[model samples]
Target: MEDQTPTRKNNSYCKRKIVTVLTATLTDVAQQTRAAAQDLAGLSTDLKNQALESIAQALEAATPKILEANAKDCQRAQESGLATALYARLKLDATKLAGAIAGVRSVASLTDPVGSIQLHRELDTGLELKRVSCPLGVLGVIFEARPDAVMQISALAIKSGNGVLLKGGQEAIHSCQALVEAIQTGLAASTVAPEAVALLTSREETLELLNLDQYVNLIIPRGSNSFVRFVQENTRIPVLGHAEGICHLYIDQQANIAQSVDVAVDSKIQYPAACNALETLLVHKDIASDYLPKAVKALQNQGVELRGDAAVRDVIEMDSATDTDWATEYSDLVLSIKVVDGLEDAIAHINTYGSGHTDAIMTTDDQAAATFCSRVDAAGVFHNCSTRFADGFRYGFGAEVGISTQRMPPRGPVGLEGLVTYKYLLQGQGHIVATYAGEDAQSFTHRDL
Candidate 1:
């Protein structure tokens, strides 16, 4: 079959027109954002409260339109013969739609991070220093077929006082466009700019938008490793997101066998297609004789294809696992198994091959739990819990833009706080630097909040 994917050259003028629309749209959004930030900063608590309430209601009102748009995307996805996994991610029903609306309301209930003072200090005779949290300006988010991501990021950006530009997968274009329209309608009624949230209409437009680093303060790519890497390589703007989640569940020697089995099963098979879901199982050598067989059998019963190392295959009936299996994120009913000497070996294996998204340790010993949490170089290290719990809504953050594996300001789930940056606010009474330069300078005392 001939490829039907749209290209820039196919419709050069249309692509150019979309870029122009984005530029003009974002320019106006930026101006309004600047003004909104100032106004929101100066507003009384009562007014801010009122705005939040209105936002919640507006999102509630837009639910039916959101669902209708998502239905079209779902229909197209089914017709295109897309992979089952991709189709599942692209499909949105009543539950997901309601969750999206609830996510916006949850964000509205959270304390606004804008204008909140983070740090303060006195540098000299009269120069006062303060670091205040502020919007990160225009945020550009490139993501895959999940339509809820559109609502999650939009609400977070608005609450944090920042503008956003979204580029979703072409498969979900109709759904995304519908979601954006609802957001625009909501913003129109409020003090926020309608263009504060814009969506890319086509893939060609997205490629051009990726290069607009000067206009966008940050670029957050949320999808598969290949897509994220592509965006990272092509864009000059600082990209924040995880490449993959080759997460692990380490069944330590000190673990309770039943509890370990439960955690391991839940982490891998409960929701295998998510980034935080377990991809590998590491069992301690001391417990491998008994633990490995039981865990492997349970996983197999759940329709998981278990690929094991030499030690693991020797103990459990499993197919041979290749070297690449150890470094892969199956994101399906597939798992890799390895036998470790102890905690040291497990930690080393994870640090070397794991994607640092989320990893877990099943142990009864407190000291072992502490060691596992400290040594595992992952965004989330869980003890006695499933790696699947490494989600924004689960963490009580309302919603998330994506799970960031980068070791930066937003390491774990990128939520409302992740959408903001800090600005240094200095207050002074016209004191000159010349006064504090001499030998007899006054000592400064900084007060902590």
Candidate 2:
């Protein structure tokens, strides 16, 4: 936590001037990053872990520099009127930096996902086949003002033996640049390629980056709905991310008031700006008489603004919530309350308005909880926990590239396993297709190995 920056051994790839030159064009960076990932795929697990450890050490040692850089971003954001929650995400102090470094160390301790044999099989005489996990080539990760995202993505990429090009929001340029510099410097000291991890500075360059579908295997954009949609439509490349986070928490008739209040406060107040923060609160009409007042008071005590329907307004003093409120994602200390008929009504409302990111239900009845969890269509469905638990680090992913709502292989918190794809390898000794084609066809044995 000293004031000085941690210095790395002299290497041209991470040098300020050199990095700028090396990342001149989006196409060039993509090609170079793909090449780097190809080399990374050949490295041993120990070597990958070493690179992650180096990144952790470097980040811990350079805490002061990172914070100082983040200070500038925070000051500028305040002057320019940045969103309250986004400013919170952008500012990195001693604690958040420590957590980021610890996450990297944890990733170092995880089992390597790449090169692991997923399946092995014996096919006929003298023929064998194996399916092994491998890196997903180069990744283009575009995220918002969360500076910690830079470190997390870089560490995850290295640990999974994949290459990354990180593009952070302009609001946290200084912080992102400093974090990437530290990461590339750490890579220089290890056996990994320094160019394996790069940073994009401008919006123009980032838009250009979305076009490199050939070199960039996957694009993960972590930001607002419009931003993610823009990235998805602008290129031919595959995109992995969610458009919105209109999460919900339904309070069942069988729910306990104290437990519901605690969860409601934690979900909205612990970190209101997060993607998993509860946006809508659904209460069964049968329990509204008992739960509405208590829920309002608990949330208001934490400086939360309550907007509710007519039935909820009758029990509490708050702003009148409209039909549009159901579909809104207020990423702040704002809560929308709606009184539903019962479990069926709550489920219908959530499915109609929820963003398919995360949803939770509070209930003492086993049947109610089971029905709610099974019927709710979301990436994460919780029975009684706070919605804030829907996070990558909380899910023990070491560090996530992003929370994916896409219905694909990498759903939910995308960790090391999400960054890899499998390849089928077949070995045969002088085997000819003619031998198994027609009347003299040989019987093949598909035995597991």
Candidate 3:
């Protein structure tokens, strides 16, 4: 306790200097990524595919190192009392790593999303207008505890002709560094520049990354509701991502009891840590007595904790669910159950409490399924299926950067199609605007070529 004032002041000054240096470094990296992305936007599909293949091979070669780094991260997270769901996402085993690599190769095989013509029209003689697809330039992707995203995003960015600046959560820093290193190594061996993908490991870098609107074309955040909301509030760049995963599954009276039970269980327990995992169960009142018991038994056998409303509790014994349960995204093996009078009531409950992520209806009745699929205001509305199926890879897009619950064009699992924007390319043989604005202008033909 001997006069610590000078030491504290010196430490504060050093911290300020370190932060300034980190900020400068982040800006430099953003500039490099921006320049690389401009070049990437014009690469041929063949060259892009070659780069993806090389990246896949590089990931395969670095499996051991990546796995070791992930293990270190998992251990550190556990010691620091990280959340169970995040810990689950942080632990990257061999199978997961291998699958991630395979996904990179799959992306290479899919059709390139760049330069596809969406429209071809002739405004007049020798005047042509073409709308062509193009990359969205540089993407700033900030995610938590999913190191394998490095591989997926890298592959997609290269294939779609965009650069990416990845900012992974602190818990997975080691894993992310290892993955990005391998990806850059792979890029160095191919036509693509290694700078096309960059990683920001420090927590302070996130705010700096968000401020780089001039360089980053879009920001995609993946994490908890509060974290995503924070990014959205603080960033000037357009953000594309969901804040919560309060998804639900409704079992209609016409649903096959066995099939409904299986789908319900799978949706909840298959991968509870995922954003599309079922958080609530809205069972039709008529089928509650018959379906709830079986569903509850199956879920309980798999170590799932059940919470029930009054009607649900009357059918099966479980913990009582409070009003807050309906809106919660329990990214764990815990589910809330509610009993509804019919299909309409179930839909109402989902629309009221759901997170607009993915909601499903289990029913054999075509009309009921149709109604639910049409009316549910979620990114994905499934009929008689597990919510887990709402994924980019499952939909044959190879892999996803993230799932978007926004009410725009990319309003689901965002894959290659979601990563691109379109540009209108017009060609003219010395055509002038005055030609179309004159009093004696000739009647020009507006025709599709």
Tell how far residue 325 is off in model 2, in angstroms: 1.6
Worst 10 residues of 3 by lDDT: 1-10
Pitting candidate 1 against candidate 3, the one with the higher TM-score is 3
lDDT of 2 by residue, 182-221 (tens): 8877888899988899887766666667778888989998
Clashing pairs in 2: none
The full ranking of all candidates by lDDT, starting with the best, is 3, 2, 1
TM-score attained by model 3: 0.94
Scored by lDDT, model 1 comes in at 0.77
Q: lDDT per prediction?
A: 0.77, 0.85, 0.87
Model 3 accuracy (lDDT, Cα): 0.87
**Alpha-carbon shift of residue 21 in model 3 (angstroms):** 15
Q: What are the models' TM-scores? A: 0.88, 0.95, 0.94
Question: For model 3, how does the per-residue alpha-carbon lDDT over 49-144 read when each residue is reduced to its tens digit?
Answer: 999999988889989998999999999998988889989988999999999999999999999999999999999999999999999999999888
Flag regions of model 2 displaced more than 4 Å. Answer: 1-23
